[model samples]
Target: EVKGDGRAEDAYLLATPYNRRVAERLAGAELRLDEPPPPAAATALPNIFALYEENIGAITPLIADELKDAEERYPPQWIEAAFREAVSLNKRSWRYIHSILRRWEAEGPDYEEAGRDPEADWLERRYARGKRGAGRLR
Candidate 1:
């Protein structure tokens, strides 16, 4: 049993009955009292776009499920407003996603289309370009 910050030197003495039980359990499990365990493995670096995509995918299904449930409880206009808010928030959340895509397009395979403006994703491009002003949406 270990105490006082669980250092190796502290393992020499068992301090309490609980400690004794822990030590006995450890012995029963056949864990060696030799050296400290190996350090945990390093975590992978995060890809912001991949994270954004994963979050978007997770939230979409959840929102869909919630909408199905919520429609019965709320008025049509209230539900519509809630749905609009959800959609607006989700659409706005893609700023980081578009930034990552733009960065990848700049550095990765598609260099030529790095900041190309297409009609479909113009909102993202506009937001990325810092076109949104104070209280514009409100």
Candidate 2:
């Protein structure tokens, strides 16, 4: 039996744990189980959009949509690291950053920069003309 008499006790009861269920029961409502809250890690992640805006350039609506898609497809840490890598490489294009994310997804990330330029390799593969042409497009 609840001790509330529709006065301060009622207010106190509403303020306490289990009070919501007690009030609902008093009102002749069915008991419903509470859903668990989201994980702490989810809340603790840094806002990738904010990080991008700060480190990269301003986001257009198209870029915003792409960012949303990337956020869903990639981990927050990967996105942050991609941004940092783009800045370090002085390649400030979203296409460049997005390519990094895609390569990381496909080939797994290389944590050690170690004098390796994956971007250069990717670009060479993408635009390499012919053996005779070398750097020139066929």
Candidate 3:
């Protein structure tokens, strides 16, 4: 059972062990909680969204945090495109997000600097499509 007085700090402390660092990162960045994309948005591409959430869930409790934090720094369209691409390539891991954010923190939250394309080799393996007799991606 979760016992808390409904304080933000208390909630942060209660985050899953794997997610504590993520929480700290978001908090340190001065993020305020905010809502995430609708469930339907994610349902269309679970692998993609799962990949996106994996990174977000690592550092922040909710999507709102990043949105709120970046509101002043990044344009909504840029964030949207970045999010969509990140989900598509499945590069939304903790490490990847950290790298992306570190650049943002240093240079500024510019989408051009944050761009990362999925590696062709990784894509071939990730889907393993049309590869007969392939037990798993190489």
Candidate 4:
């Protein structure tokens, strides 16, 4: 049964065999699935750990260490994008995601088919160049 606050307590979760397993997993994760993601520039995306668990698999110790290392080096949005790109490519491993992020960092993101308008980009660059040139004496 749920509490008056409509929240399920450990007692309720532990009462069921399946829910007991879920409770144990949650305890191991140290993160609540119901809690909002930590504040970041991109708040719309799901929490990184939850997203990984849902899309990939349970976060083993080695994987958790890798995630922490990646978090230190990459922005949350880059991580999210890498995950998306991996899933799109049907390569759902963290290694694939890491490689995507590394490639983006070293070579820049490939904007082709990423919902960008090449004409608009060219125009923007042209406008910027015009502004810069206007300030110089020809």
- Candidate with best lDDT: 2
* Superior by lDDT: candidate 1 or candidate 3: 3
Global lDDT of each candidate: 0.46, 0.73, 0.51, 0.71
Q: lDDT per residue, candidate 2, 27-127, as tens digits?
A: 64332224366567645656777867887769899999998999999988888888878877677888888998999999998745577775676567756
Lowest lDDT block of 10, candidate 3: 1-10
Candidate order (TM-score): 2, 4, 1, 3
Which segments of candidate 4 are over 4 A away from where they belong? Answer: 1-44, 111-138
In the order shown, the candidates' Cα RMSDs to the true structure are 14.0, 11.1, 18.9, 13.9
lDDT of 3 by residue, 5-97 (tens): 343434435668768776656554443345465566433333323444554554355544544565456444445555554556666554454
Model 3: how far is 134 from its true place, Å?
23
In terms of lDDT, model 3 sits at 0.51
Q: Name the lDDT value of residue 43 in candidate 3.
A: 35
Residue 81, candidate 4: how far off, in angstroms? 0.8
Error of 2 at 130 (Å): 15
Q: Give model 4's TM-score versus the native structure.
A: 0.49
Identify the runs in model 1 with alpha carbons over 4 angstroms from their true place: 1-9, 12-20, 27-33, 44-58, 61-92, 108-138
Tens-digit lDDT track for model 1 on 1-138? 332333333355458889777777654343345659999987744332233344555446655554345445434433333233334446434434344344444565232355743333656655665665533442
TM-score of each: 0.29, 0.51, 0.29, 0.49
Error of 1 at 63 (Å): 11
